[model samples]
Target: MKARTESDSVSAVAALADSSRRGVYEYILEADGPVSRDDVAGALGMVRGTAAFHLDRLAREELLTVSYRRLTGRSGPGSGRPTKLYAPAVREVSVSLPQRHYDLAAELLAAAVENSHRTGTPVEESLRRVAAEAGNSIGKDADSLEQALEKYGFKPETEEDGSIVLQNCPFHRLSQRHTATICGLNLDLLSAVTGKTGPEGCTAVLDPAPGRCCVRILPPDRD
Candidate 1:
């Protein structure tokens, strides 16, 4: 799903690189409802043909959805063909070079926060539990620790001293603001994945380094 989303987002972004197409896209995005080609052309000072061309391009890229509706309030035998309108297709677009899963991280944190509020559990404990559950879910599809890490875009690289370091952090931005919370959540998640793949053989430790995730998976006997 993430891979597909990245591909779609890249295509969508590229489609908007044209000034005319970008203008059409932005106009539709700002509109309260679907916008007609005429409305876009008039609003952006573009010719009708130009607007239609760009709108169709955007629709083809899945950036905008096309619909048909009567411009007049009344629709009957006298009503002509419905006017074509365009609106945003996907509410959001997410693309990252290293394929960060901030949405996944945000979901776990938000759920943990809500559970803590409802059940009187410590926020930290709830976060750990939620992170572990999320990790375990992902681990089910992976046959090995390396496979799981790679799948999630951790870019896992083994060091000379028998330790594994993640070259990229999926929750990079969140970790900067909520250091302890997010890092702890990351540690718990990796620990759960590690346990499922290789029980008692490795552990995730909070060992921050430059341009890397705060948590590092360490070989057994190190912790």
Candidate 2:
């Protein structure tokens, strides 16, 4: 499956916002396997047409996957046309108001722990290394530091001094509880991102302030 963007997630959540569509989706989810429109309509007390409409809408939004199968065992000649079945899509849809990325943090921390155990390196060192590597991957495709930061929900704001302040932290909750470790990881990640994508000699540094991310990006000429 292709990677789902934030827009895809938003669309999927919106598709489920309708009470009828959500009911149809829930019914299909509880089914033992892919379900036909008739099955959904019977189970949910909905008309077949209503069920079909919801199913097709969900499928169009990529919330549900579609397949075709003949419910009855029969030869190709006389068997009726294959029934369209709906199943939950493999993709996960998540939408946070401020746009948290705990999954990304989990992935980075899990990899760091595994690497630490394997190579006997300190967990902190492993975390920094993995975070930087992840940042490098994110930065590679970005045209500029602000673009990359914005893409990942950092909410970068440029100051008149040519510095960038992150207006929002994507890992806000995690950082609140585990300030030191998460902030260090954030710094390493953004520093590497700056190295790859920021202006010449620009750097990311930890400069914690209320209501903003701990990391700030400074232009090369800044003192």
Candidate 3:
């Protein structure tokens, strides 16, 4: 299926607002494969009826899909019946950011710095190198910016204001969670592209819209 739209993202989040729905969606998002409603209930500690309710809603929203499979000949202790499983849908139901909130960069950096400082794992250094390399390749053309960022595994789209709005973050996918380290790296790269920092040692993602975002060049930084 095609990528979900901003509107769809909003709807998806709203649909998951219920605690049960949110748990079900998050569980599915974390799973490696599809599961059944009974399995989902057991995994999430939910009653079968409530689990079925959320499962149906998620399926209706296209956040999940269901299918029946052959049940083992031997039924469970109940000796009642056998059925297929309910699993996370075929697609990952998650939010996409056309633009990273400026705070994200700082938050990521802070986390990375703290973790590296504590563990001495060199994650911070690695992140710095990636940012430096990504920054080095950015150029005047919008296409060039997109290409350069893409090389670093960032899917960036050209914004109307000539800045690039990042659509996909490989780091988030890799980590399977949000962190300050990745945000720090993004902040560095963004700073390099937009020139320099201002009030927050960062810049705002200006006028983010369909396939686009905007940025400003810091006075002392490169244009």
Candidate 4:
């Protein structure tokens, strides 16, 4: 999920990198509603085909939504084909190097804290339990532990020593400010998901390192 979201951000950024496309996007944004290719070209003094190419590109990246409408207000064959219109799509895109997921952590922490306060449960305990439940819910439909982790953008990588290292932390931003709390939440989430997969000889433990998540999943012990 995180990988895909990141990829989408990259694609969106690239699509708008062109000055012409960027101009077209801005024009549509400022318009009252959906704008057609002709409208964009006429307003921007761009060639109709050039405007169309950019509009199509934007639509492909989901930056814009495409619809068709008739300007003549006539609904018969003589009314002519409906003009293709471009409108802004509801999307949020953010790109960060090394991938950070502070928002996810903040949301979980906020919910846990609020619920804990209301129920009079200890914060740490409530956080751990809630994190576990969240992981469990994510893993419930997954075919395996790795799949579950990948789906949530953990970016797990296996070491030669039979340990799995998380290459990215979705809660990195939150972890920076509240290291202990966020790390604990990460551990619980991974542990719960791993537990659901029932992978033998594996356990999640804190093993902080630069450029990676703090928790590592170790293999079962040898005799």
Q: What C-alpha lDDT do the candidate models reach, one value each?
A: 0.86, 0.92, 0.57, 0.85
Q: Compose the digit string of candidate 4's lDDT tens values, residues 28-47.
A: 99999999988999999999
Best by the TM-score measure:
2
| lDDT per residue (tens digit) for residues 95-161 in model 1 | 7997798888889989999999999999889999999998888788789889999878899999997
lDDT of 3 by residue, 15-79 (tens): 98988798888887788877777778899999989888898888877878677654665555855
State the lDDT of candidate 2 residue by residue for 39-113, as single tens digits: 998988889999899999999988899999888877588899988988998778899978788999999999999
* Better model by TM-score: candidate 2 vs candidate 3: 2
Off by over 4 Å in 2: none
**Which portions of model 3 miss their true places by more than 4 Å?**
1-4, 73-84, 90-223
What is the full ranking by TM-score, best candidate first?
2, 4, 1, 3
Q: In terms of TM-score, how similar is model 3 to the real structure? A: 0.36
Models 1 onward score TM values of 0.76, 0.95, 0.36, 0.83
Worst 10 residues of 4 by lDDT: 1-10
After TM-score superposition, the amount by which residue 204's alpha carbon in candidate 2 deviates from its true location, in angstroms, is: 0.3
